[model samples]
Target: MSEEALEYYKAAEISELQDGKVHSREVDGELICLIKLDQEIVAFTDNCTHISGPLNQGEFDGCSITCPWHGARFDVRTGKVLRGPARQDLYTYTVKVEGETILVGLPPA
Candidate 1:
């Protein structure tokens, strides 16, 4: 992760994130999704692997997220392709939380 990437999510609070919900946020001009599952934090690109759907509007069930535009499903934790229509996996980011702040790191672009 680059220094600029680290600075982007330096102030995210885990408490602000609701469980079983997907939150959309922009960092360094990139759309990212912050998902909370059973108190665990996960980050992934907001774009779907198929047709570039808005993943923020997608439905989530436990560890999987179904794309809103298409019927593709993806694992929020590993960004794995769980269902068809999207064979490729979404981009994932490293997440960490400290006290009231949540941090996510993306690879240097």
Candidate 2:
């Protein structure tokens, strides 16, 4: 494993997130969102790019999530901005699964 992979923090259990659902968790004081898309779990910063709205409160449509505050939308898999009042993309995190545990990679401090 690489150094980046070594920094993963346990965010959730694989069974905790159902297919086509968005789940939020706070890890080390950082709010993160986990979405199960196409049987894969993707993680992203829970804050919306527009005005720091809670992304976990947004609407998820299997492939994209829309910010509830300002109508910004992002691709769940790549964090790409799909529709925008927000120009920036969400900060995506790397996810790993070991047995039933789901780990999210955190950036170095």
Model 2 residue runs over 4 Å out of place are 1-6
How high is the lDDT of residue 55 in model 2? 91
What TM-score goes with each of the models?
A: 0.87, 0.92
Tens-place lDDT digits, model 1, residues 7-80: 44552677778998999988777899998888788989999989999999989888999999978999899999
Residue 15 miss distance in model 2 (angstroms): 1.3
The best candidate by lDDT is 2
The numbered model that scores best in TM-score is 2
- How does residue 44 of candidate 2 score in lDDT? 94
Model 2 accuracy (lDDT, Cα): 0.88
Residue 4 displacement in candidate 2 (angstroms): 2.9
